[model samples]
Target: MTLRLSQLIGGQARPALSEAWLDVHEPATGTRYALCPDADGEDVAAAFEAAQAAFPAWSTLPPSERARWLDRLADALETRIDDFAAAESRDAGKPLALARDVEIPRAVANLRFFAAAATQFASESHHGQAGLNYTLRQPLGVVGCISPWNLPLYLFTWKIAPALAAGNCVIGKPSEVTPVTAWMLGELAREIGFPSGVLNIVQGLGPKVGQAIVDHPGIKAISFTGSTAVGTRIATSCAGNLKKVSLELGGKNATIVFADAPRTQLFETLLRSAFQNSGQICLCGSRLLIERSAYAEVRDELVARAKKLHVGDPLDAGNQQGALVSKAHHEKVMGHIDLARAEGGKLLCGGNAVQPPGRCEGGWFIAPTIIEGLGPYTRTNSEEIFGPVLTLQAFDDEDEALALANATPYGLAASLWTSDLRRAHRLAGRIDAGIVWINTWLERDLRTPFGGMKQSGLGREGGQEALRFFTETKNVCLNLG
Candidate 1:
């Protein structure tokens, strides 16, 4: 039975404005499992209307009241953790453990952290010789939030939680490719008795619904997570309206390994960093920079490790990696591998897409791939392949390593592995990325600023930064006698 998905207007799941439906395929097995509305501007306008209606009251509530609702949402999500994890794994072709252990948990944490932040939401007051100045952090009216297919609910909540915590009503659009879990969120929202229009979920093609959200003047602010090209368009649109925008876009991130780093830990970390979630994550270390002293060893070991990853159904306990999200995306990733060869890079290992024996034979699966002998500025090295593919390069010294790492147009995130405390701290500062992990990758803290620099993205999001982005500040001054 194919499940039907609808646009979540106000607090309920209503039929889309049109009867046209898009088939939702289960990425793990390449089977049609559901249908989502092929929503249009009418659906978007309806959602915007709901958000505008709910904005006045929702935005004026005491921060603590919003905090309580956030907590309630978190509690509800926790109760459905297993279900969400399974749905996410099946929906996105992520290994079930990865979904259960990382993606879903982080989403729960995002909600909880933002809920606490709402309780602690504070304004600023300055006392001066002449007068007193007070700054108010208040919500914009109705806001638009668009998240990509990659992280689905994890990032969907990341944008909306803070927007809601800041007291804004949100009209959210989750990618049509992976809309299941977000629709699930809409179902949960109704159960929780959430205020109507506070957080409406719209599922559709980005061109249709996403464009409508961006074009709608009623939406005062927009927070989007996706490719740089789309983000650029959003930025231009928002600029025309003088609307606030926070974009977390693409990344061609790097993993830097110094010879001084422990070899054992480095190998394991690199495997997960490069191949985890089939490299669908924007933060995945797609470019690897190794010290010349250890380049050969790291490259050889990475190939051997890549061979060991089992690509199959996400639900299988034995499989560490799963299929790409769709056949179209699978071909796109495979094409990059061919592009690497055409550009004269040597394929270290794993270039061809595979049909893992049994159920996964029907799915869209690509083996983890590594390409070497490419220059720093080569397209394969600089572009975000955004699949289970990596480009390996060698560097002679710290200066050379930094140059190679920063060669790409992106400056999202990177990982550094070295034993020297001084060198670790030094390289951290030199790396142009927003988040640099010394001897680690993907370690996150809710309170720290998170986002990219340069073409990677604009503005930061996380903890106070997220709350700040979703809100506006008004300063008032009074003269003293």
Candidate 2:
């Protein structure tokens, strides 16, 4: 399918003023599938103007009425699931089934979740002797959203649904590499009857369009999901203006498996956690901390499971894993695997790139890898690799396990596998991550709050907590005579 790119401004698809374009590659074959327009400063300015124009009405609309539009969007998305899935897979290098069955559907569920929460937007009043006091949660005027490429559609929805549900107009800049899906989402929003300018999408590089959105005087808040370095830069940009900011950044999350855990179940969880989306997830369990007693056994089992994973064309139903986002990313992941070996980390299983049988030769594919004996402070242990490489480290006891888990600069998400309920509860509390899964990994419910502590991110996404992030609370006092 041929896809053309345009800016979604003021509820219309308009050609970008700049003639510059980016080639959207099909990861399965490393072929340029489409060309997406790269918006310049002028385009961003127009989008900001449209958002500025739309803010007043959107913010003032009754919560119930606003929610109705959101519901319509949910319905529209449900009907076009197949299109979204295919586009998402083609754009972001995700498996077709994952895009169609999981990512797109979950995004719709998120929209509905936020829509229901929108109706509960109410000010609470308390009578005092002096005056009546009430707390009002008001929307920030215009929010600038910057989403990354890993899970483009799902992450974009994470920013958009809650921001809109909280009555804030938005101008979003999706990563140039994966902007097509976001542009399509903008088109979907328009079809569902959202007011012009309520949601504007501009495609461009970070320094050009993304910076403009962040530094724009009209944008009241900034929500960014990307690397820690980039997130820091965004936060700094928003600082002088004092614009509200929510950042979901990088993570080197750890998965700890205890001796008492069910080995087979643990192996499955670890495989999915490390290789899902080719391990590009910010919350992926990149570091595997196993109890020393089970290290050899766990390593062998994990290697066996990794060998069975099929890596190939994303469109093929039989392919369990797909290519990385691009050739550069493929090389970067392989570099990390090489670095692990140089650092004396044991290569227990797959490390080199592998082309699955009958798959296209040019695709950016990497085999799922497991490396052992790396220490907590080692490069492989401390950094967020952001690819299909898993580093293994052993711990002598529970204390060592917790210590290794918390050693990284990130505190995003972590998982624990153990049969003892008491240890699970106790360890969960001690873990510094935002979300801790017991005997599971990457099991996300749209209703649950998800984010991280420290370098992982600031603030949360999902559930009622997300609504609060998009809004500002005001205390109002009145004397009723």
lDDT, candidate 1, equals: 0.90
Global Cα RMSD, each model: 1.1, 1.6
- Pairs that collide in candidate 1 are none
CA lDDT of each candidate? 0.90, 0.87
lDDT of 1 by residue, 1-481 (tens): 8989877898888877888899999877889999998988999899988989998899889889999998999899999999999999988999999989889989999999999999987888998655999999889888899999999999999999999999999999999999999999999989989888898988889999999999998898889999999999999988997988999999999899999997657889899899889999999999999999998888888899899888888888999999899989998998889999999999887898888777778899898888889998778888888999988899999999899889989999999999898988998999999999988888888899999999988999998998888888999999876
Candidate 2 residue-wise lDDT, 1-481, digit = tens: 6577888999999877877887888787788888788788899889888988999999999988888988898899899999999988888777999999989998888788888889975667889576899898999888888999999888888888889999999888888888877888888887777899999999888998889888888788888999999999988988888888888999999899999997656777788899999999988899988888998888888889898998888898988898899888888888888899999998877788866556467788888888887788989888888998898888888998999999989999999999998999999999989999999887877678888899988888887777888888998989888
Where is model 2 more than 4 Å wrong at Cα?
128-130, 356-359
Error of 2 at 72 (Å): 1.0
TM-score of each: 0.98, 0.96
lDDT of 1 at 202: 83
Ten residues in a row with the worst lDDT in model 2?
A: 354-363
Candidate 1 at 149: error in angstroms?
A: 0.9
